[model samples]
Target: MLNKLTDAQVKSATAEGQKQRKIADGGGLTLVIRSGSKTWWYRYRFAGKQKTYSIGTYPEVSLKEARAQRDEARRLLSENKDPVMARRTKGIRQQHDAENTFKAVAEDWLQNQETELAAETIRITRRRLENWVYPKLGTLPLTEIDPPAVLKVLRRIEDQGKHETAHRIRQRISQVYRFAISEGRAQWDPAGNLSGVLKTTPTQNRAAIIKPDELAGLLRAIDGYAGQPATCAALQLSPLVFLRPGELRMATWEEIDLDNWMWVVPGRRMKGTKKAKRAGQVPDHKIPLPRQAIEILQPLKQLTGHRDLVFESIKPGRPISDNTINSALRTMGYDSSRMVSHGFRSTASTLLHEMGWQPEIIELQLAHKQRNDVAAVYNRSARIQERTKMMQQWADYLDSLKQGADVVAINRR
Candidate 1:
């Protein structure tokens, strides 16, 4: 009967116009039929449970291969391993493999950090993770990330001579692992124990300060700058207020009370020192806006006052980047060592002291906190009137130096 059922007859069971029905093959093999189609499957029972293993499509898998798969499935079935159970186990393994990809964990990390970090900081962190970490470990599972795997990525960044940025990347990896743990996606953070593993070179801090005499040269460079207008304003204002680089770039018109002659730095933007808190209202810094400074604002107000920042870039809506000031400095032929925008603060503090200006006045103008708590609180006039005068004098002093005029050096007597 097996020989009489020609291979053509067996194969034709899957052909069109045939009623869907199972055609039996010798030895537990059957051509399962449904919807005018057939597929070869092996049927057997394991421990009172019936099971079927799909071998292949009808004609594509010849009778020979079907028989071969059936024999293999049966041999395993005899070994007390049901073919169906074996197939289920293999599928589970593949599912786990799919879940362990790097992109899987990175997405988890990104979502976790979104709440705690500032919007700009989050954007930067996401960019680095996507561009640097994903390409390297995107296909790897979180459980598989080891010290070596992490080090390989950091090593690549280090090789490019970006030591500072490489340090930040390592910190980011640690944060990602922490994020994973918080989400219950990972058990441990391998990045936590990896601090001293890499050979670190000692980094010398560059103190940003411009000397008083050298300020003339710096002013000439800035005045001579034929570059971005926003940059020129930043350079001109750095000495006037000496706010932090971020606060300077992110300054909005709302914070500046020109009518009151005060730059009321909000509580959020004020430095986190005890002095900031003790000086109620963060001592709304009366900038004593000079004529030149007010002139700068008139055009800038027409330009950016409608938006959040006082000095937004020409690109529209976006605040100027933190680097715009320093980049402008570079464009004017000053290297990082030569002069930084931040260094102008130090320059003013030093020169003002040399000019016999009171330390309290200079410190107040610099937005520095008075050291003695009670004294700071009690003395509301701690250079209040004097700072207004000092600011004007300083502006005039800058103008004189810029024109190469022999300005009256501060009398330290």
Candidate 2:
């Protein structure tokens, strides 16, 4: 048997030239001395073959501890077990244990979702989890989270009059549980059975004035309003474009190709279909600018041309608040129940359809999804020339209404 190594001898051990040197500490344990490091290794013959097992590094695992680990490995070897395999198994178990917590699994799920979700969406999701889910269920094991535990958290949100937010939290929890299931951290989604359990808020359509006379009065109010020039310009352009409030508010100067009379909203900014989001293929939406729209944008461009955003806020580089348009409408005496910023879309859609514009063209111009997949594809390529004509005509029609043209009331469908 080889003699055991001493602490002084181990401290003095060094690699010779480019080769590593090993000093045996009897049995199956050996001290490997490298150029800049020392490690403890246990070697033995098992099942008619020699096997080596790493005990640990020296200084960290002293000589006494290394020998103790060697003895444990030999014990495992005598029981027909491979110590390396056992160590690996233990490591995997520990890793699973660490990752099996609800918060740990939820974080992993959120990380995976970052690639698929928008930055703003991801931020909101993280905030929701941090504020609501994490505090209650985060520390619990994935398997330990149940419906009641989740309901308790959701009920708090419900009590706060945030029924929609409570519903969203439930859905997020369900997604987290599903992710955990896929990762082998959970068995089932506890939030899956939560459907119809929470109180449902009645759907309310955005209020809009579809009457020609009322719409004309609203238009005159916007025209006469004395506000920030940019705000006034946004109010003027809103009825012309009829874009979603968020989409219009976040419009950047780069998105507009003024010379070409087009605004190409990138796929990232557009509200895509669920299928499109899943497939990671959000198509760009194009808006053909009318002459009236161009005229409105021209003056605003001169005012805020140096910035990225067309409707910039007081804070440089930031877009106006989402409530800016609605607040402006309210300032013009249109209450929330009477006219919202989103009411522009409904007003435009109603009037265009009443004007006998093709339903497909009007819907496409409104950036709504076509139910038929092939039709959706076709609509994207088709009717651009017609849409351009239709938009200019629509702008002309609005101008006529603003100028007190004859009001023809078409029956509401």
Candidate 3:
């Protein structure tokens, strides 16, 4: 019988040329040393066939442990069991366990989410999971996560006085569970049962001045805002177009058509349904600029016409910071509780609705979705003539309000 190989001998062994070499220890145990790497294996004859069982790599699996494993394999073989088959079965179970872990399944779901969600949204979602969800339930199997386990994580957020965030986290967890179920990795959504379990916080609408007089005051303040010229233009044009703050700040010159009195915001720039994103097609939102809006933008073209972005910041290439408009509003004595940048949309929605305009037409102007799929398609081009007139009328109304004209509130018909 050959003597057992020593650790020193295994470490000293190196492959000559390109060929790997193996040294045999007694009792079918072998040491493979090739290219400065060492591994242990067991060679045996079982059921009239030769079989090899990988023990583990050297240093990671010490010689004593490998010998113990080899002895155990020999014991199994004496009982007519195949050690190689046993090791393969054990390895498969470990792989299955890893795949079924909550972290593993959630990662898969997040990868699928990348195609539908915006990059910023994806980043926030991943951060939330890494911070809160993963630390608690990540190592557990997907199927093992129950409502109580989920509630424990949410309660921690609630404890921090973030009631709204707790609700949002629950929704995100529910989405992950749904994804797991669809992939056949889980059977039930524990988070679905958590409805109303968390404390409810009142919804806070964005601060906006709906009254014509107050809105007029806001317009005057914006006009007199002694800020950056680009910021002043943004504040002045915000009411005319009433776009989302991001859309307004990130506006490019190519999207504008001065002669046609139109601004075509691409679907990617505007917020839309996940279905729209998944289809890789979003209808461009067309904003028909009234004469007043054109007058304001034409002069801005003289200053920023050479650049790609209409609202370039002091930094040369980036758009104005999101805080610019809100900060401008603050300087004008309107705090967040009284008014905000997003308030422009609310201001437009309320006043336009009060002006006896058709709700659908107003919604179309606001780039809001229609009630159904058919209405959404038809309304795209349905009221262009009316909308053209309405846009001009709205602008003229703002002008009247700014001039302190006795603007009578039009009742809804």
Candidate 4:
């Protein structure tokens, strides 16, 4: 029995400041109301409950548009569902998606990335996520993330003067976002648009090898180091074998083939390369075992014999601290730039080259692949005899250098 809503009547009611009119045609409905303003709404009974939902302002929605919206709402209601509830459920879902936080995605990214990344890499990635990224943005979902939030996390680390860590964290976050997209967990990469948004800084390279002249000083210094004997031997051998710090620290008695004069670095312990998957053999490295090197190991065997590593730490089975080697170097008057424990490789490479040994032999001794192609395997024997002689001669050369004797190269070719 409601009258049709004419524009003139609608305007006249609004002007008179009357409570707005109600106009209904068939099942369609429109509400005109004023509370310091005129507006429209649709009212109906659903499941025996009355519900009134706004259809926007009267003039903006108009009579025709209001009727259309009313019909759509009723059609949805006829399906034994409440339109308001349906709309509420859709909104809840969108909210959930937008709330997918940084911490949750990062954990998922770390687990799925287990296969693609190296063990050491995985360890570091997880540590960074746990220690730095998680506490900051771990709860925020990616879709709702923006640059300012990301910059805030980065700037916190930067404020601590860990610019390098900050840069790496940003890079790690980007990688996580990429992984999320690939796994169908995310629809877009929020990290993609970040450019010039963060400051770029160069990180200093700290790897160093002691100079040839300084080897004598280092040897003499090791003799004086007040550290544990096992620490001393490991420090001395670091340069001689030039093994990776982890490889050196984790040396197990089971892996040593002293009879063959080879230390077979098992694949699990080695860094990735074609040879890493298969067992890689480090030749006896023919250490004539300097009296100093031998002396340090002899007594230490009785101490760490029960443990796996030749230089097991006081922490029972744990390997020595990553800083143990470098710290020993620093105590010996070498800074990171002067000499790093890893710099032994460069030291050996340079000294062997200076001693007039063939590049092939030195490179082979170094276990460096001459080419990247799979077909380019190292010729295991190109320098077997030469390396044996070179290592002994190199030991003697180090002795002479330590004694401040004029070093003369012996060509054992």
- Each candidate: what lDDT? 0.72, 0.85, 0.85, 0.69
The worst-scoring run of ten residues by lDDT in candidate 3 lies at 404-413
Candidate 4 lDDT by residue in tens digits, 1-413? 44366667666564354555454444546655555556666677887989986767867777677677777787888898787787789788777665556777787777776765666787987898788878877877777677777778888888888877887888888888887788676777665665456666666654665465667777778667788766877886776667778878887766654445555566566556333454343222222333434444556667876678788877878778888989988877888878787788888787788778888777766666546423224354344566667666776677777788655565666
Kindly give the stretch of ten consecutive residues in candidate 2 with the minimal lDDT sum.
Answer: 404-413
| lDDT of prediction 2 | 0.85
Best by TM-score: 3
The model with the greater TM-score, 2 or 4, is 2
Candidate 2's error at 131, in angstroms? 3.9
Model 1 misses residue 122 by how many Å?
1.4
Q: How close is candidate 2 to the true structure, as a TM-score?
A: 0.69
Candidate 2 residue 92 C-alpha distance from true site, Å:
11
Give the per-residue lDDT digits (tens) of candidate 1, residues 1-413: 23224578875665355556777786788887777566887878989977778888867988877887877787887798888888789798678757756677777766765554555677887788787788987788777888889888878877887777667878888877777777676778767776677658558554565554577887777777775566678777887667778777877798776666666666446555344445453444445676667766677677667778777787887777878888888887778987777787887787778778988777767767667745654443455667777877787788888778654576433
Give a tens-digit lDDT track for model 2, residues 247-317: 88899999998898988777667786444656645566788899998998888999898888999988888
The segments of candidate 3 whose C-alpha lies over 4 angstroms from its true place after superposition are 1-95, 277-281, 406-413
lDDT of 3: 0.85
Per-candidate TM equals 0.68, 0.69, 0.74, 0.68
Native-referenced Cα lDDT, model 4: 0.69
